[model samples]
Target: MSRAEETADTAAAWIIRRENGDWSDEDQAALDAWLAASDGNKAAYWRLKHSWKEADRIGALGIAAVPTAPRKALARYGMPVALAASLVAAFWIGAIPFLSEPSAPKLVASTYKAGIGERKDVALADGSHVELNTRSVIRAASTSGHRDIWLDEGEAYFEVKHDPRRPFVVHAGARTVTVLGTKFSVRRDGGDVSVSVLEGRVRIDENPAKDGRPASTTTITGGMSAISEGRSTLVTQRSEERVESALAWRDGMLSFDRTTLADAAAEFNRYHRRPVIVTDPGAAGIRIGGTFQASNVEAFARLLRDAYGLHVEIAPDAIKISSQGVTAL
Candidate 1:
């Protein structure tokens, strides 16, 4: 394949991967990097995406193939409505009556998104405040006496104003968190959502499957956390100090209490473009703890080299970490 064709195929693969499954933080980061690499990649991906959606609608409407000059007419008709007319003229007229437009979503929510290494503080019209973490997206709207937020990806801290008439609900993946007036932080990674309450109380509802069965709900008070992933939901209580530690990012710091090197690398990668890749399993599992600026990956790498006798290789694309003897590829 030509270079352009190869890039187009790569873009198409990324689009397919995102559409077929839950895209995690790593996938998002890689996609962001690929898009940033070239403008042609972005155009090709979007074109393929639009084509796929159009193909889905055409297939669903059962638009059969046209014969002879009708095929030429069908090709000439560019718009969907014109194509529908051509298909109807070629086939049975009653088939057109069976086609219906796709149903629109019930809520018309406003979306707020934060780019990589960027944090956003958004104030809702309803007196609620939200602090969106890097590379996060949330859709919020108030209707039918309910204030709902859908955390599509990444983390957000919410400070909800008291309103008994309007219950605040946050839908993240398979879990839903309901609060009245509370300060809470929610982190969504892939199919999991971690909720940490700082003030007041909130109830979390979890649905393991989409079978319409009753969802399990649990109430979490201040200094409590709940993690919902797939079929399991775990709730735990943390000390006030720990709760403060978890919210350290609000103050432009990342506090890690004996965090694994691999985990620490992942955390730091969330804030910056150059990923810290730990090559060796032993080096990756090494525990380190301290408060550090989220953007200072070089300092973190230096710390690993000086304190733990690890090898740090600074490359153009990534910061590779490994043991002293292990060679970094």
Candidate 2:
């Protein structure tokens, strides 16, 4: 097939996925790649997308008109859009709209994806250790003088061997995290992306050239972490060992050093089916500290219940948490 045909096919697939509201990471990446390949591709995709959204609006209007026979004419207009959207992507997982467009043309672009409940480790040519966790995708290549990886989604732990000339940079949405030689994990969870350092130090900054945002910076040392909305963190310069508690899950152990119960429970949810949901927002910041073996996170809940007098109730599809005893703030 011609490149345009292949591109159109890919775009059509993406449109169908989004219209169905079941767009997956794979489909979204394909659409992003197609857009970055040429402005023409983006224009085509957006054109279809606009048409589809308009169709959805029409469908909603038609649904409202069903009770009002006087509004039946709007129903016909809605049918075409509904049909197009059905062929587009209205029922599948919604397409993520955060893909980045490149600044200039390039010869080749790479793609990487990880499945659910999966873990992978790799040693780069420069002696860097890359550990990719479940359901993550990242792509990287060196073109000019810089080395970088675009993390489409999920988390990755990187132990970058020192290279002064070619510093390692990780790209997640609008953020670009840089490291000379260090051990760190970058996790892109929904809108809250986090970076935790285990060894050496790394710099976190915005990529203005890509997103045109003012540059903000942070330096994370071993056992330190920073979290941001999308990519801006309200917290930073934390203790390094504390960051270890969060990263220890990769090693099959859970560690906590003066972390709050709410934070610990959130970590537990990462590995549990029924996530721990804090009923009381006040409990989210309660102070707690200790080293507990990384086994079933349920054990941690029981420990809290027994020792701290907290109420633990397990629902059919979820775990609910609430304070039982009067506790000091």
Candidate 3:
């Protein structure tokens, strides 16, 4: 009923879920966040986990443990009440080591972030590599059973190491990308998520009951892309050129093949502080094609002036483009 008892009860529940053998990456991430919240939570979880292991050992030896009442209560409640009781008893008698002397090294989640116009490279413990794009954030951790990554914001490219025994999963928004080994990228824009595979294959799963629709899973191979918005997902095949263009940001370049000025501006704004604003509908509708440096907005604006003959207004916070009384160069 008290805080300590509640913490112990939660810890016991986690142990049961873990031993059930169906524990997921999301579940492990939630447990890690809980343990990192406070020292009391860590102590409670480790104490209960240690005691549960001991209980399993004794049961394997056909020994009659003293916590008979808690064992009988497990059948009715479906929880490890015996382990909880044993943990409490051990604490009272100083029989079990606490957080100061954990049985094994704790696996803490690692977080990586990239600022505006900055890219970061991370080499994971399992030989996996991650490249975070500008203004992106990700959290990763690897256990003996699986590797998990949570894309908190923006975009990231993943070069996953091949390990069939340990599945690699990336959680972005309401969708999950699962794979054994692959080269892919995940981009999160508000409620929409996109997955593009360059090599190998990966499976994308949408969360259940989103927008009143049942969940769905789509497997995409190399040169394939999946875009999920709300509960609807569209998987389409991409040509090699399209795939390269989509991933051009990794090389600090933005590639566009007849992309609209409005759309192109949106993509470039992701990496720069000053935005490109097309005030004229005609200018916004103009289609352009080329590759440009992602961080160089001034050059892009100059191109509109010299090549397109559009009126370019440069302000302190933004670059405004208009097609008023303008003729093609």
Candidate 4:
């Protein structure tokens, strides 16, 4: 295949992967290689992908083709109405009796959803990466002019490409994280929203829903984390190690250091069909630190017991962790 053709095919393959919502490391590597090879390759790939999307929209309306209009209005055999009908029919090559034009939402304004206990990786038009965690729903609007991923609900880790002109924005609650380039996780559990920075820098702010409105912008540096409570942005030292622990579900490993028994139990409970019951808030505050397999919930519970000197009560539906008459402190 010619260089242009090869690039187009690569883009097509990536498009298929995206349509399937199965973006893998292999596709990422190909995209990186394509970009490094030549600027022309990127341009050609984008052009074809853009065209393909338009074609998809057309096909969705049950149309095989939309014909071009003739230059200027012209009388054809003194039969103006017939010519108009033919033009309309040509423009809309679909099933007859095409009822009221469906108010189809824009593709990106639309969303791809994942249920609980599910994780999916998707590649956007601008070559950015997003890993949607369990019970997460995200919408991606990918155009050459702009790229956006809006996390409507649940959690997602984003790796946005560097583009000064087109800042990648992730909207989760009132916390809108804007980035030119970075890797970060934005999670909304209930009414609380947390922004954890993994790489590069991100501006976490309260962007306005309407134009001409003021915003509350807070810049959280790398290794730092913030949570939203009410109208203010609260900043605190996000245990770099613990931040990794919070997202360990993505890696199939649960890592924790200096975390509380209560918080740790909560994390594990998300995966458990039964709750990790905590009776006392005091007991839950015991210090904990360790790395363990996330798949084995019982093992993790034992690790907590052995480390924190807490008593573990195993129940059919849940496990309860409480004080052993002493604290780990």
Q: TM-score per candidate, in order?
A: 0.67, 0.58, 0.70, 0.58
Q: What are the root-mean-square deviations of the candidates from the true structure over C-alphas? A: 10.4, 11.5, 8.7, 14.5
Q: Mind sharing the TM-score for model 4? A: 0.58
Supply candidate 4's per-residue lDDT for 182: 88
198-308: candidate 2 lDDT, tens digit per residue: 888888886443234467887777867888674456555567566876687587676776788788887666555667887786667767777665546567777777776
By summed lDDT, the worst window of 10 consecutive residues in model 1 runs over 92-101
User: Judged by lDDT relative to the true structure, which candidate is superior, 1 or 3?
Assistant: 3
Q: Is candidate 3 or candidate 4 better by TM-score?
A: 3
lDDT of each: 0.75, 0.64, 0.79, 0.65
The candidate that achieves the highest lDDT relative to the unseen native structure = 3
- Of 1 and 3, the candidate ranking higher by TM-score: 3
Q: After superposition, how far is residue 295 of candidate 4 from its true place, in Å?
A: 2.5
| Ranked candidates, highest lDDT first | 3, 1, 4, 2
C-alpha lDDT of residue 123 in model 2:
61
In the range 1-329, model 1's lDDT, one tens digit per residue, is 45544654565456546654566767865775575466456554555544543654555666665333323333443325445334333332322332232442234467799999899999998999999998898978786588989887899999999999999999887688999999999998988889999999999888443343677888989998888877778888666777777888888789998899999999999999989999978898888889998877898899888887788999889999999684541
Q: lDDT tens string, model 4, 73-152?
A: 21221324433334323323332222224642223344666665567888777888889876788767755556667676
Q: What is the lDDT of residue 270 in candidate 2?
A: 59
Candidate 4: where is the Cα deviation over 4 Å?
A: 1-107, 209-214, 236-247, 324-329
The collision pairs in model 1 are none
TM-score of 3: 0.70
Off by over 4 Å in 3: 4-107, 210-213, 327-329
- Residue 251, model 4: lDDT of 87
